[model samples]
Target: MPRRSRTLTGLLLFTSLTLTTAGIAGIAATANASPEAPAAAAGAHTAHKAAYSMPGMPGMPASTRASGDDPDGDGYIMADPPVTGVTPSMEVPPPAYFHEFQAKCAPTHTAPDDPIVYPGQPGKSHDHTFMGNTTTNANTTTASLETGDTTCLAPGDKSGYWMPSLFDGDTKILPEGVQTIYYKSGVTDYRSVRPFPKGLRYVVGSPMQTQEEFKNLKGTVEGWECGDSFKNYNFPATCPDRQDVQLNLRLQAPSCWDGIHLDTPDHKSHMAYPVAGGANYNSCPADHPVALPMIEFKMAWPVNGDMSNVRLASGTGYSFHYDFMNGWDAATLDAMATHCIKGGLQCDPHGYDENHPGQGAVLDENYELP
Candidate 1:
């Protein structure tokens, strides 16, 4: 497959907002592509609820694959293999009282393919470092995600997460630390928050635009930071050698959904952030009323003490953006939102709230709840 630069470690790369559909449904790949940096290839928006299928692999006849997540009887392996029993446990934590829970994820792989943007076309998209689901690629569909193993502490969270890669000249910088993912209520009435819809996916930052554009854009929680600094627009010119200091970025996705259309032509229209609803409550807009758990990505990288020669695969730090595809088991995810966010307690990836130890979520050593 024709491809871009890919490595185990990827770009701390961030920044970009331009996204456009490259091809039509069931689009076929070719050597020639548009002049624009393939970063513009957002997932194609289609009229059908079913995502567009990719070309089949060699020797893998539709009937030859093992039975898996394909509950729809498509004769394809769509889910992860069955999981074995795991031990139930909880983590010790300090007292806290916020309706938020967090999951930890590590980078799994880097690749040029994006199932959402350039599905089925292995080498067509920009390079990205992926986490959560380990087997993500150009052919990865929402169904495929269900059956894939995850790097996240939450095993049920087979969801796919990825962002542009970072590089020091030619050397790819792997994310040395875990990405702390938080699920919190975006509105004042935490009771109204719901779990993400099955197969729901969206892009969080605009890569096509410049760093300045991303800063003013809505839904951005932070740009880049080093230690105590919270407003570094791009990669810091130089990082300190302290334990607390490291290069990292933060992003927040919209918490309100239209309750329909898993995707749009732009891949972001179906979702919206909350607005003032009066009476001490923030509410989803009239058009998009469903309140889902707001997602915040706190990603950390290994690079520090660098004077220069750093850049993301997309562009500079400003081009930073990321993507997420829901793959959590419906019941498990719902229980988390209900028990934690709705319960108004701070929980971990395992749904274990320190203050509410009695309500600990049953999970395994890997931190995933069955």
Candidate 2:
């Protein structure tokens, strides 16, 4: 199996716009916003939803073999194996859904662990800051943006960005004497707007295009969203082309938050998995089990040759990064939290009960590059 690569930490500062009608100009105007605009002041606005995306990994079929020397040695041993004779599990999930979200200056959401390293440059390092505090303008414009220029942009923390673990706590834990973890495969297709969504940013100093390759091949495809019924919601008598090829190979566990417990109304609760169940090989360790979790996705539009920086166009170059955080449900979270407590790592849950910390464990820690 080929190893995944890490992403660049920082880029040279650049000026960009916020999304507002009149108070602030659109991203287009920001591309031309005069410095005389009195340097827009920061407002009291916080990130509402997590911005993240999975990046490309070696295709699942190819990734199945752990190494060459031991080519056939338990090569198919996975907690959840891939579906037989279907689209490769590594391809993007089918019917990828797109959501409109706010775009913010990158610096405001930096992770503490993010080290400042200028993009495409080496040896020189510096802190990054955002162009503004909130998207006060309604027209949605970004102005006078230039990469590698210090006068335009800013910095933010990049710590605790990716999902700590699929289990929600420290260490990879599996049941004793388990025969195999079961998983099903399905796909989801996703599309974007003309200029792509704005106000989208990542605290990890990472780019969004990196995750596209991953998103395209590993999107989750199950439950109501994937032609299944949770309510009286009548789905297609037969799956449509819109619902072609994309699929998620997940553990055949019951419905619960974050892919446990088979009962639930939401499909987004399902996270994309690389190695799922029901195979006759060994892709992962038998005694020690582990899986990746869903995280925030960050993406960026591409700037053309003559167009001003802020008016840049969106393309496959539009990178995406997933920030796997603590959003799993109580049961799975508590189990991992228990594991972490035993290991001496202090954790505190972000959105649940006071006693239960939504701590995540680390599994395959690396950037998802296409």
Best by TM-score: 1
The positional error of residue 346 in candidate 1, measured at the CA in angstroms, is: 0.6
lDDT of each: 0.63, 0.19
> Which residue window of length 10 is worst by lDDT in model 1?
8-17
Candidate 2, 215-330: lDDT as tens digits: 33333122112223222111212322342321111212111111121100111212223333344211111111122212222221111122211110111112211221121222
Query: Backbone collision count in every prediction?
Result: 22, 108
Quote the positional error of residue 295 for candidate 1 in Å: 0.8
Off by over 4 Å in 2: 1-215, 219-273, 279-289, 292-318, 322-370
Candidate 2 accuracy as lDDT? 0.19
Superposing every Cα of model 1 onto the true structure, what RMSD results?
13.6
Question: Residues 1-370, candidate 1, lDDT per residue (tens digit)?
Answer: 2121223101200101111110111212112234553334333211111122223211111221212222333231211221113111122223334888887877887777666654565755566888888888877777799889888777788999988777665566767646799999877777777788777777776555456666765666667887766777777788886776668887888887655446443455556777676655567765566778999988877667773877776667876778888988887788888888888888877788777798877454566555
The candidate maximizing lDDT is 1
Error of 1 at 107 (Å): 0.9
